[model samples]
Target: MKRQFVTTENTLRFLEGFSALEKRGAEEACLMVVDGVPGLGKTSIIEWWAGQTGSVFLRAKKEWKPNWLLSELIEALGQVPRHGFEKRFKQATEILANKHEQFSMDRRPFAVVIDEIDHISNSEKMLETLRDLSDTLELPFIFVGMGKVRTRLTKFPQIASRVGQYVQFQDVSLDDVLAMAKNLCEVPIKRDLIEFLHRASRRKMREIKEGLSSIERFGAINPGKEIGLDEMAGKLLLNDRITGKPILVTADGFGGDNE
Candidate 1:
């Protein structure tokens, strides 16, 4: 399979949300929330975007406290974390403020992304600290989680009111699956196979990639043939993560057990 990142409708929506957050009128309203079910590619896309934009990305820990978050932010900003929580907080804000100014001058979108934010979403202290930092610096903070962050944020009206954009990742469409196969697969795949994979994977990005890998391997053995549903029949296309069995393509459709 080719090493690539395929832009889908979800990615475009996320970019739109970020653009809206960047152009927000109120400084204090600088928060963005992105949520989706597992296997939808929320973390994968956010990590890719962070790398491209030079944004500081932190994965929230189950036991995260305000001080731990501050320390992580300080280190991510390329500075040594100070001993005391207050000192670390000050350091993080100063560095983030400076970086925000630099990004503004360069016309680049800058944000602090907290992935797995659900871990800390219930902690009022941690959320309050994040809210305080964003409010103080007028910088954007993006919270990425597995479908609950949006509802959880409502508990903190102060934080919820400050959210400038909310992006919910949805199941990939057949078009998105086709784009991924075209960009990431090593060999040509027919529309029939692509559509089958889309349905078999239930439109999940992670499962679609797994199915693509199966097609790529089959294509490699065939050498230059465009793989289709017929060619892929009786082949293992995806693994049933819940059942620990291979899902094989059959003449009529797919089944959890191998043909």
Candidate 2:
């Protein structure tokens, strides 16, 4: 199976939200929040967008202090890290301001995406810094966190109000499953197999990848044959949630036991 990024419904929704927020202009709040359940490809979508737009991507960590965050932002903007928290913060802003100035000439927009924001969602200082940067730079600051991000932001009403767009990702639909299979699978997969894989993986992108890989392996072992649930009925396609290992449930080993 080939590894690739498939544009599902979630991707389109994210683009729409971004376009809407961008249209709101710098006069309004330019912050965007993308909160979704784990394993729903939120990071993937953000990374893709950042790559396309030449945006800076930062991953927040639990141990990140104010200085650390500022330094990261500075480095992401391709500036030399300076000493002192105030200087570093100012340097980061300066870099962004210069970029914004250049953007004015070319009529291009710049954005920054901070992923795993839930790690420091409780840090008032960090959130305040983000708000200040968004206001000062007047550039789009996208926050990517888990499902509770919107609820968590309520603690900072000022920041929450500035959220021009908030996108909540949901589980994959049947069409998403089909699209994923078609993109990853090299051979023609039967509809019944696609349905079975979708349900078995619970529509999670991570598990769906695993299930498709398993199917690919099965197909490789048995070439020139249509893959189906019967080939996988006695084997494990996904891992056990708790143990992180394969869990196979077969009927008495195909009735080999004494009856």
Candidate 3:
């Protein structure tokens, strides 16, 4: 399989939401929440976005406190963390403010991405610290989490009200699966095979990628032949997300022993 990032519908929606957040009138309202189920590619797309846009990306730890978050933010901004929590917080905000100014002068979008933010979503102190930073610097802060983040944030109306946008990533569609196959698969795959993989993987990006790899492996031996569902019958595509057993392609469709 080719190493590539395919642009799916979710990715486009994320970009649109980010753009809207950046252009919002109330500068203090700079928080954006991105939530989705597991294996929907939220972290993958956010990491890719950070790399491409020179944004700061950090993953929230389960034990994260205000001080720890400040320290990580300071480091991500390419500075040594200060000795005290207050000093670290000041240093991080200064660096972020400077970077935000530079990005503005260059007309580039800049923001901080906190992946796995559900870890800290319930901590009022941590969420208050995040809100303070955004309110102080008027900078965008993206909080990426699983489906619970949005519901959990309701407890903190001060933080939730500051959310400029809420982007929920959905499962990939058949068209998205076909696009991934065309962009990431090295072999020519028939529509039937792609459809089977889509259904078998339940339209999850990670599972689809695994299925694509299986097809690529089969293509490696077949050389230039176009692969169809028949050619992939009885081959292991991916493991069942629920059953933890290998899902194989059948002549009729796909199923695992447990299913």
Best by lDDT: 3
> Stretches of candidate 1 above 4 Å error?
254-259
For TM-score, candidate 1 versus 2, the one ahead is: 1
What lDDT would each prediction earn against the true structure? 0.89, 0.80, 0.90
What are the TM-scores, per candidate, against the unseen true structure? 0.95, 0.89, 0.96
Please give, for residues 1-259, the per-residue lDDT of candidate 1 as tens digits: 8888889988998999999988889878999999988888988898999999999999999999898899989988899999998898889999999999999999998999999999999988999999999999999999999888888999999989999999999989989988888889889999878877888786788888999999999999999799997888998999865566777877665452221
| TM-score, structure 2 vs. true | 0.89
Worst 10 residues of 2 by lDDT: 250-259
Our model 2 lands, by Cα RMSD against the true structure, at 4.6
User: What is the Cα root-mean-square deviation between model 3 and the actual structure?
Assistant: 1.8
Candidates ranked by TM-score: 3, 1, 2
lDDT of 2: 0.80
Give per-residue lDDT, candidate 3, residue 81: 98
Q: Residue 149 CA error for candidate 1 (Å)?
A: 1.2
How many residue pairs clash in model 2? Answer: 0
